[model samples]
Target: MNISYKWLKEYVDFELSPQEVCEALTSEGLEVGSLEEHQAIKGGLRGLVIGKVETCEAHPNSDHLHVCTVDLGQGELQQIVCGAPNVAAGQKVVVATVGCKLYDGDKEFVIKKSKLRGVESNGMICAEDEIGVGTDHSGIIVLPESAKVGMPAAEYYHVESDYLIEVDITPNRSDACSHYGVARDLYAWLVRHGMKTSLHRPGCEAFKVDNHDLDIAVEVEDNKKCPRYCAVTLKGCEVKESPAWLQERLQIIGLRPINNIVDITNYIMFAYGQPLHCFDADMIKGNKVIVKSLPDGTPFVTLDGVEHKLSHEDIVICNEEEPMCIAGVFGGKGSGTYENTTNVLFESAYFNPTSIRKSARRHGLNTDASFRFERGIDPNGQIYALKQAAILARELAGGTVSMEIK
Candidate 1:
């Protein structure tokens, strides 16, 4: 599990540095396997900053290239050559000047003064995928106008200098799979050891349900396999990119932020140690969910577009007509929330760890949700986790909340 140093601060305001925190975590039995600093990778990323395009004109020598003057707030404008189609004047973009080290996903290189197509190129422009911050390479990264010029891109984005701490969780210690769980342990250790620290301790957070007059229908055919199942109905939910804070939190922890609806479920999983799944309300047949074991040779496709055949030993989350989820494993492809998703059925459940482990290996699907389910989770926390995810869904995606599980 990779835990972000900055993210742990949200739960406990620890005054220790990131390295110190890693040491403290080890003492708490959350043994750290390896600690990596983002900026410390391959020396560092210096001279990377938010720059405003001052002027841009088509290159007389190259059709695809443009010459521009960028204002990096260094008291003088710098000349640069860019080939991104979306590069334009008055836009704030990422600038990697001479002496800066950059990674292009395939190789690491140093930015130096160079000439391209007869133009004196002093630096290089950046795209999201170019530096591996995201998968979008449609054009150069355009920062918001509120982005301050001359600010280091690392400081501006709050990443590029973060730390990634890798830890090993024993099968018996499934609770430490989440950052919150690890921090919770650390806090307890500090208190038991009588260590004094300036960090503000964030106690347990309560989930409140406002709208309760909802009609959500679900049935569990095999209670022995699935211990607890909880869900919340979100009406009129809009799917869109998550807010900057949410996206940054996920990205820093090596998770690709999808849409707001899906990100909320992922956030809850990492924060509360419960894996939640989001199903498009319309895709669920009869607006009902059923948890059961299927017969042998039952075919299904996962959200990642992979097909699998299930046996009687496998548990599934199905609607009245078809499988909506593979129980605690991967979810069905068609039932996932997407850009067109309006109504969402958010689900959080605890399954028999042994059953989930067996099914996961048989189906050859190893996912984050499955990893947690196979190790066990706090079944009693299902309702709290579901309602918390719903609140975030309503706030981030503009939805109406309705508690679905009793």
Candidate 2:
């Protein structure tokens, strides 16, 4: 279990540095594996700014190069030859001046005052990956149009000091797999050390099933195989990119942010110790959902674009039309939520561990949801978890309360 220091701070207020927190957690029986600091390339790349693009004439000697006079905000213009097609006047960009060391890939390059096409060039502009935010480097980063001429880009970008701490949690400590659980442990540590602990529960209440529009009808075809099941339906949702705070929270935990709808489900699962799934209500072929054993040789495609064959013993989720998702394992491609989806049907149910494990092993699809269901989570928290997802969805995605099943 990887616990990001940034995410861990939300649950508890501790004065300890990230390294100190890791050491403290490790001393209290939780194994802190390693801490990784993601830093940007280019030393002395601190305060340079894109003052102005004085001249952007095509390089006389090179076809793809543009020689421009860039204002470094220190009252003097610097000449640099840039290859990016988007370089323009008044665009704020990073300037790695001469004598600066930069990390490209596995090696480092020292920037030196050089001549390009007979023009004395001083520095180079940077991309996202070149500055270590992400792997995207298709184009030069255009600073926010409002960025001041001489302001430090690092301060504006907040890339100064962030670290990721890897946590090794034992099987019995499944609760620690979540941010709340880790915070619980940290709270205990704070109390033990006579320090202040201020962890509070979310103000939003658990979702109630009786107050929605659409009714959720769940047919547990084999109760012996799937011991418990719960579902909720939400209407009028807007599926879009998650808020920066939510995306950063997930990114800190090593999860790539998909969208607000999906991020809410994942956030609820990590926060309340229950796994939840959200289906685009309109994408479901039928109004009803059936959870049952798969028939012999039923074929399905999961969300990851992988095809899987199901046997009789495997459990799956189906509508009147076809098997839409492999229950407790993975969602099928045909019935997934997309950018235009509005209504959503969220699922938070308990399955027999053996049943899920068998189906996962058969399909060779072991995922976070499967791993949690296989090891067993708090079954009674099904409805509670579902409600949490609904609240987040409604809050983040602008959805209406529709229906729920307790």
Model 2 over residues 1-406: C-alpha lDDT tens digits?
7676766777788888888888888887788999887443343345344455667888899998888887767888888898888887667777766665667666777777888868778887766676565577777787776777656666666555567878787777766767777888888888999997788656546444435677657788888777888887888878899997788777766789998988988888776668888888876666888988767888888888988888998888888778888888899996767898888898888888888888889889888888888777776878667777877777788777777464
Global lDDT of each candidate: 0.82, 0.77
TM-score of each: 0.74, 0.75
* Per-candidate clashes, comma-separated: 1, 2
**Root-mean-square deviation of each candidate, in angstroms?**
5.6, 5.1
Give the per-residue lDDT of model 1 (tens digit) for 139-174: 999989999999987777655467888888889889
In candidate 1, stretches whose alpha carbon ends up further than 4 angstroms from where it belongs are 39-45, 48-160, 197-214
Candidate 2: give the clashing pairs: 212-402, 213-402
The CA lDDT at 147 in model 2 is 70
